[model samples]
Target: MSRQKTESEVARTTGRLGPAERADNWRRLGSEEFDVVVIGGGVTGAGTALDAATRGLRVALVEARDLASGTSSRSSKLFHGGLRYLEQLEFSLVREALRERELMLTRLAPHLVKPVSFLYPLTHRFWERPYTAAGLFLYDTMGGARSVPGQKHLSRAGALRMVPALKRNALIGGIRYYDAQADDARHTMTVARTAARYGAVVMNSSQVTGFLREADRIAGVRVRDVETGEETEVRAQAVINATGVWTDELQRLSGGRGRFRVRASKGVHIVVPRDRIVAESGMILRTEKSVLFVIPWGNHWIVGTTDTDWNLDLAHPAATKADIDYILEHVNTVLATPLKHDDIEGVYAGLRPLLAGESEETSKLSREHAVARVAPGLVAIAGGKYTTYRVMAADAVDAISGDVAGRMAPSITDRVPLLGADGYHALVNQADQLAAEHGLHPYRIRHLLDRYGSEIHDVLALGDERPELLKPIPAAPNYLQAEVAYACSHEGALHLEDVLTRRTRISIEYAHRGIDCAEPVARLMAEVLGWDDARVAREIEVYTQRVDAERDSQLQPDDQAADAKRSAAPEAREKLTEPIS
Candidate 1:
């Protein structure tokens, strides 16, 4: 049969690179010009690239490390309306976040983001119930709350029944509110990928070493490929600086005087087995300074978040015993069965790039983000929550449109579903059939669908070629062989840390820190990546040392001591000594 060519074919033939065509197109980067160059591979930068590309502007995104290597992947993993922001009377922030939440859950990355219920336990009976109810009532109506159900009030007895792990005396009642959650790393990567799908040049581990200046205006950047140690000069009419915590450093690189300084506030989270906390839903507890969340991940409960001023290392913020104790102390007061040191399976620390303010209270700092036109051709955006990244992205692209020569359209990301969102529903309906045809269990098919959505077909195809790839991983029985291969091929997972920490979440989900599974997983990855036995062994050893370093640091008394101990681990990337031959 003869194929009919349409306008879409015309568009494709007009020489545009889709997501699947990015690596090849990125090869032609230094040889051509870009309309807009984006710095930082965090949520905002990736979104900006997507926004600019979808608006029919030529775009390029460069990252110093892998995508979401910064604060984007280390977030609370919630797509919320900033319930705490409401207390601060930041109604606009809350509304904007909620609107973004609705977009993600409904039209955007539906598969990536899903609704989660949180139990806000009431410590005061009469005053709190009505007081909270009024606020929640208003919360329900604002910023398109249709994506999640409205808050439901529960009595003291009812609250205890829902969260049996909580102390019976801790709450007088409770209110259950709904918010969406997502795999932050996966979503950020998908955003970058989707942007590439719409004709953006997305490349990872490519650092913008220096800014290319044309007199007073910023023209482009000098990019160094971290993997190959190759340098390229990428020219663009406009450059967007979306480096979250490193905004000042990027500004300095661009020779632009930053209008504001971004201060890093360290937040630490501990992950423990879910069985230790027997609860029907997640809990939201108020601490002395800030709020704490007991979020439910797949096989574990994530209890956290100590907010303190951090002047230490930014790359890997170490969690001390004191930080863990602070979280455990406060949460233990509310829990019927207290958590111990041995109960924790994982500990992670991330810095919040709060817009610097005069206030001493880090918690009191604004969650509201800002975008600035730093130089003649440079746009910088910082200090935004993950939920409002799209807004930040839209604002960023808008800031640079005047500088872009060609006509640039407004951001239409609100209507744009992410890479795997379009056919997710149909894939869910077809899971059973897919499982039957593939000779795999229906449960496995469901797991793949939840993680990859419609992209499950791509994963299945990997195993389809080699039936051995369908079998379960040796130690980590939950993951399949094909997943390890898929992570490397499709997801751009270069290191073992990328696979364990972000891609599959084995770092936190497993009790042994993936020690037992590391070798097997590394071997599987080696087969796909063509890594020799020595290289595979080296990867495993490095990962093991990192796990050991983190464990040793967590057992330390103070942050300084813990950070010093964790810093003893090897560097994330090698220093540039010998250039690529």
Candidate 2:
């Protein structure tokens, strides 16, 4: 694990995450000693593993669920410089985030993160436009927002041309600004894959059950695979906890008081079809509580989100009736044609781990993250924006690198492009030719290239012998059958829910929340995962119940009621007997 990487070894760039890799990593975790063992598989954890591995340190990143299965996947999916933070006068945080944004946009992850425009609708005519413009000007200059175009001012007529769905009197004018957007789940998974390419043992569905200690000094972690129920002792010189909202829970297991407490705040979003609100670009509207966004998705417009205090299940933050109603009520005020319940396609909820501070409301809580050496050889980082994951990761590893022997290297992640980053633009240029070679349309080839980048060949290779995989999924045709197969074979998807929910996003992208495709997707996963008939049936049952629970939760009036309803669905993985160490 401590061997230095060589130039010819770049073929490892695929960063494949399948059952075979997981099994090999599990065996390695039991036998080899690591320089750092990172908990949680969110973006921060994945970034930390990359930071450690790139520094020539042996590292392993473990997660209880799929990569980005938590808050990382359910973000507003923007790499903006925190336009709202500017209002709070948090110049430094915004500046740091913008720097990371430019890094992802220009160098690190161009394939996943792309430029997106948002129109800030004006209500107060002269005052609003100037105020917003000044704020945007500062945003542009603060962190080198040069990757995308600067802000553009528009009159009412021009604004209507931009978004025809707006009520005639909704806004007097508007200002358009640029920011980057990404499929958060895909981006996080790529980061993990990149870390693996650099020789980090990255595996999902591996839960850390307890901390390992040697005479009161942190030694390593006791991990259990959620899929196989196999426990292993993974020794490390240092351990990093990047569990986000679950920070407090892990800290308690360490039997220590944390440097700061984390508070959970629930944010909910609803997805509707693209035609629901006719718009050339996304829209941003002001609300008394928080800002509302109508972001443009591929074939849909994502409208959301409501921010409120949450004291329920962190894993499954349920979106109640009131939450969806609040969003519709606010967005309805300006819409020429108000969206109805039937127009809704999907709903999702994620909990933000805000650093608990002196704030009366969760919305006003601090988002700036804090890291601490909770104990000897143990480090924990909690609370930060999604766009600044790299910075958060650098700081986490910086705290523990002193414990590793020899001269520790500085962070080189700024120059480290993700797995699909190399040759992405060139492949995009040859999309038509690639389509011809693959017997598909140019648009489909372009889509695959954007998602898989240079690794598009690996995905396409899955269907070389089995051509039917190149066809679309019967239930959710937007995604090809090969995608479902690749989810298990290359993306570490262990269950049917993981395939529909995180890996491919058939859950939120479709109207049925992927229920119709549950059986078919499960069957495909079974082929790769070696699931029996009973296991396949259970996977489908768990997924169906999960979908039903979410719908039931959305109908509830409050958090407590919604949580109780949502928790009714059983976990996809059944509890196994004591793990064979």
Candidate 3:
């Protein structure tokens, strides 16, 4: 169920980031002088743009690729306080993350973020329950967890009742606690859209080539349109480098040694069907290295995450055979029926930009974020968990006080809800009515509400001229044709890869990894993007090759071989160049 907003509320905040919007923003990027110019289009960069825009600062955000194309898109999709961090005695970090979790669940993104329960199995009978209970107590009470339910203890029989797929000898007891989850890519894109709604000029496929230096201080940046190979200059009082794994690389481009170096830690996750694991609630298992999670997706189970050091291509982090085997081997220990390679529907790898530490092990690295003014007018933010991105954005903006003129207003993003957040509850209650009006099922309407919230009206309005757009996609029936069109018209999705992979999860959620629906989706996009027959064929070819490369990479034995296989595919943004360190 979802709620509806008034027409004025929708019109006021639901500004489209369509093709025209990008063209207008590109003109402003070259002509307008801004107080802040943000590099990167991940969660942090988008959040910084929002934070600055809400403060009445003239802001522009430029991304090398589509929004959430990096680590932001390929995460575990949880807005959780790292439960394992509590064991590290990092109470402040856990509490801060929990607070942010609560904010997103209640006031911030109620439509996107939802409460999810996780059961922790107790192996050693006597001490394990109480020991885990104490940590969970701090988790619930330390942060204001008013909306979510508290912890509950269950016996072996109770545990088996909740999760029938778990092995009988796996645990003596279980403890259940609450956390939150969302579509990370969608949430990040919404934040960027919200920033645009607040008057920030946000454009994707626009890369920052180099820093514009005036004497010793940084003035702005040299921008390049990755699509057209044309260049322009953006003048600003302050520039924020929020490129996650690429932080050190971007800092070097500014001709300054960074105060801290960001090391890339690779994490891999595999997606399997829901029927493979018969669990009522998600599970948290203790591994030798770190904790493993079995998260619940719509009709699938997302299990994984192997943490290891990565030193290869930052753009395409490959998941090798060893990585997939590691996850399956660990998870199979407790499952009644073990999962195999044949059961895997999808596999993805992402790099975390951890601040380099003395510890050689990537798992031992800190999740705490740091902000440093690397130069007179340049600030770089790196490290940090996904849950604390708002706090990080605030700190990054605060560090630029010396660069910007006048006493800049403080960040008000804490109070500012993302574009689709407001009036979402009312829209949930009106889902049936919306479904009736839009000529779709109530379940489909509910799906749209979760993704677009009050902006569902804007998405549905596109189908008025073309009634066929309201139907479900041929191969990817989970999504509608309207969504494919909306990705180009409203969301800043330029390439077919952007639409299939980021804008929608067809790439990972389906068995064919979007190959089955490539041609259809490309043709749908062509209607909005003005692509001819040759262009449509080219888009499908590129996307198919990328998918084939990923599949081949996953079969490799190690990172080196996997990287070679994955990197063989051509980039969707052909004109974009990687910044040399």
> For residues 95-209, what per-residue lDDT tens digits would candidate 2 score against the true structure?
8888989999889999999999998889995578788889999999996358888999999999999999999899999999888899899999989989998888888878888
Clashing pairs in 2: none
Candidate 1 accuracy as lDDT: 0.83
Q: Report model 1's TM-score to 2 decimal places.
A: 0.94
Between which residue pairs do clashes occur in model 3?
A: 1-428, 2-427, 2-428, 2-429, 3-426, 3-427, 3-428, 4-426, 4-427
Between 2 and 3, whose lDDT is larger? 3
Off by over 4 Å in 1: 1-26, 143-145, 576-581
Error of 3 at 212 (Å): 0.6
Question: Sort by TM-score, best first: what order?
Answer: 3, 2, 1
Q: Pick by TM-score: which candidate is best?
A: 3
- The better-scoring model by TM-score among 2 and 3 is 3
RMSD in order of candidates? 3.5, 3.0, 3.6
Clashes of 3: 9
In angstroms, the error of model 1 at 229 is: 1.0
Candidates in order, TM-scores: namely: 0.94, 0.96, 0.97
| Per-residue lDDT of model 3, residues 185-287, tens digit only | 9999999999888888888999888999899999999999998888999999999999999998899899999999999999999999999999999999999
